[model samples]
Target: MRKRLDFLSLNFLRKIEIRYRLINCFILVSLLPLLISGLLAYGETSSATQEKVRVYSMQVVKQISQNLLLRMEKIEDTSEELALSDRLQNLLTDYYGSDEAASAQARSGISKVLLDSYGSFPYVNQKYILDRKRQVIDPQIFAPLANSVARLAEEAPDLNGRPWWTLYNAGHGQRSLAMLREIRFTGNNRSAGLLFVGVRPSYFFRIFEGIDLGYDSSIFIVDANDGAIVVQNRETGPGNADPALQQGIAASLAQKRDADFIAYTGADKMPYYAAIARVPHTSWLVVSATPSDKLNADTRSVRNKILGIGLLCFAVSLLLSAIIARSITQPLKRLVMVMKETESGNSRIRVEQAGSDEIAVLARKFNEMASKLHQNKEQLEDQVAVRTRELERANRKLEALSATDGLTGVANRRRFDEALATELRRAARSNKPLALLMLDVDYFKKYNDRYGHQAGDECLRIVARVLQKSSRRATDLVARYGGEEFIIVVAESDPGGAIQQAENICDAIFELKIPHADSPFGYITASIGVAALQPDDHTAPERVLRIADQALYHAKYQGRNRVVLGSDTVHTL
Candidate 1:
């Protein structure tokens, strides 16, 4: 009986001990900390997600605005360039009251340039030039708009000598955007005529290509002066465009409320997040609207996840608190050290995932993150290097194309002008003599008349090669001044050396034996004018060019195939 009693006592004590341990665990692990932690995590994650969405939406709107501004600026710049071009200006200035052939020539040059410029920009639907006589150079362009709006662009008092934008109705309720620029003679800076550019609404479709936001989100451009939609995304249709929403947005933007997102309530009583950015150089605003529910959807998902994670962590902690002991501390410390190492620019550092517990999972995630970061760093570095190299190559190619003539493979007129100025400056400073040779094919117009223009071009190319070979010094420059006209600059050369070089150039062309039935020699030949001068600091490069030109005329007058010094003394080659 005593043994049976002792067994019962032992069983009772064991039951009590089990109950006590259960109470202790519950008290120690309590749901309070879990609820508090879940709430904190939910709050932090929601705020972060909301902030990120806000920033991302604003960036999208700003990017759209920047892109629109860039295209507008390009158009504006092209217009400025066309208006300021000397050849085009001369053509336009002479277009009025000119003969048919002259007018035809002017139109040809103008059209070629306009088409080439237009081809680079597909957004420009239609381009035309309205001359001083109010005649459209190109027929397919809008003549009526050119006659009316183009004139307004030139004479309107409200424009303040700036470009004007208008919306043209293209029937079927489709509208097109138009920019009108007043062309002026660069010589006089007075209004000469107008340049017209048209852009259809289709441009916007391509402008927003590859750009995406969440559902029910839309971006559009509107006139800042008046709330008129210039371009709208597909989502912002007539149904979605609420007058109340528009007015509220306009009001918010008018107040210059902030350079970030604003809260707006639409007519349907649904709240929206709106962002606005101004399109540079235009009275347009890029506006983006996102539904509040959609914007917060990510935050809501994070909140639910936080709650679940907190619950799971609470259960796991309760089970492992006593056994985990100091194991968690060491790995966590190691993880912290590795993170510090990664933060200190060592993305190759990784944590070991020794087990399948939460700590091990965390370590595995850290390792994965580090590996991805390292890969991304390498990839970004490679892309940057490649892009830098490509950009450098593109820039070099552009520079070469800009400075070199295409037809003759020599310096272009612009490059010649630049080099002449620099060389003159150098000679003036060093007190040295510089020589210039200006020459043209004898009876070149007759050559073009006898042979076709293509033959004439080939002859000119061959002549350029001969001139380049004659000027052997590295400091010498050979350039095509214009059609059938080439110029050579001999650095640090006296008049005698220049005359010798000119004679050589003349003899080389004569030896080519190219067919020129119209010439006195019955072969291709050249007339060169030599000008050498020790120019002072005040000497203009134009003065040297003018002297060379005068000598060239004297050479032509004296004989067909000879060289003339600056003093008009002829040297038979």
Candidate 2:
């Protein structure tokens, strides 16, 4: 009976292995076609998406460039109109008058001309005259030009008989693009002065309408002379130029060429694709950028769809595999359940086979295997538990040794230093006060020599206990700081409060009365130094420690058994 059962079990196990192999083969065969189809689909979609993105980006660039050029032309035309205005001509003649009354009357006439011309073109902002000396003749324009003339004088000393256009950084939150045209008066027909028309940035920014770029996308015009951004779409807010994008745009301007579609970080530290084009008529560059993800949205959608189809094909293959695997695994499921129950100390379950195939043979062998596994499980569990407990104990010992001071049974200097740094950082960020106390056992070496090394250990333990008890707050820490020295960190305490706490700890250690007959100082006690820190003193935690250490050195120098406070003069021990 046993032999027959063994043979049946072997045959059933062989049939299960065969079914597994067959299912694997089916999966491979099915997946190969699906994978190939997915790759081909993804490749086609990627190509199509890239092409679409290229076409769309090029179209956007062209449209934006045309729109900007048209706007610049309109501004140029308006500038020409101001240059030819009869009123502007009359105002320029009066502005160059020699006498104070004549100059005052000229200023009045020019202000009137500006008010009249400003009504026609609200974007004019201001209009003024530069005299033969290139000095601003209009009081309204004098403020921005007064300091700027010194700078411009260095750049261009002889501004006579010249028609020049330049951009200037106007004070009072304005940037002016000015055009200067040399004018000859009707009487002398000699160059008398220059006519200047200042256009505000809003005049150009008004053209950036009806564009559907993403919310983060921005369009800006920068002055080529100094690389300061002159005009940008106001809707983008101020300081929206990311340094990386600014550098890229500056490079493009320096090279005097358009940049490729490149990824860059924006002012907000978000990724974007940037392209720059130089303006034709001025020393200015136009930079247009959109979020990189927005530019590739269509491509991502197509790629997602292709991946989705691939997943669907994989899902169908898995479903078919489950159905085929179920036929061979049905009997094994019951056998597994019986085996699990047997493992839980119920070993009387008998295997039942549904068919006369190899499954029947496997069923009989499963019962015997379950019996053997059940017998060995207890011993295996015992060994595993013992090994786990030993490992856990070793880990605990390692952690304890890592944190503990070998000599004093308190936290070591390493742990104390880490805690002090962390607490100092926390106090700084929270704008709170923190204090440190340095304590040293008085005449520790004498005590060690009198009562031996074992007694020295007992003395350190007693001092550590006193320090631990004195510091009651959860934020307070007492640490053994090398041989015969200890330190305490007290958080959220002021100088006076820290001094009292340190004195209390000193008295506590003195009360312990550890024997030190051979010591220069009578009973065993500690000299303590206290220092407090405020939020503004961000110099380092170690600096505070150095201050406390200096105070402690003074304490030891004055006497051996008293507490000293940190101040302008270190308090005596």
Return the top candidate by TM-score.
Answer: 1
Angstrom error at residue 569, model 1: 46
Cα lDDT tens digits, model 1, 122-141, are 46767778776646786334
Measured by TM-score, how close is model 2 to the native structure?
A: 0.43
Quote the positional error of residue 551 for candidate 2 in Å: 77
Clashes of 1: 0
TM-score per prediction, in order, is 0.44, 0.43
lDDT value, residue 56 of candidate 1: 84
Deviation of model 1 at 27, angstroms: 16
Give the clashing residue pairs of candidate 2, or none. Answer: 8-361, 9-361, 242-267
User: What is the RMSD of candidate 1?
Assistant: 14.4
lDDT of 2 by residue, 1-573 (tens): 646544444444345555564656456655566566666776777567545554555556556666767865675565556656777677676556567686687776765555445534646655665576767665644454655743543344344554455665555555576655665765667765555666766777666677555535666766555566767766442333567876776666666565345567766666776656666655666666777666556556666677667755565566434444454566678788887888687887878865555566778787677668767889999999999999999999999899889877788988898998898888988899989999998878668878888889988888888888898798898899777889999999998788888878877876777667865656898898788878454658657776777678667756768777776455443
* TM-score attained by model 1: 0.44
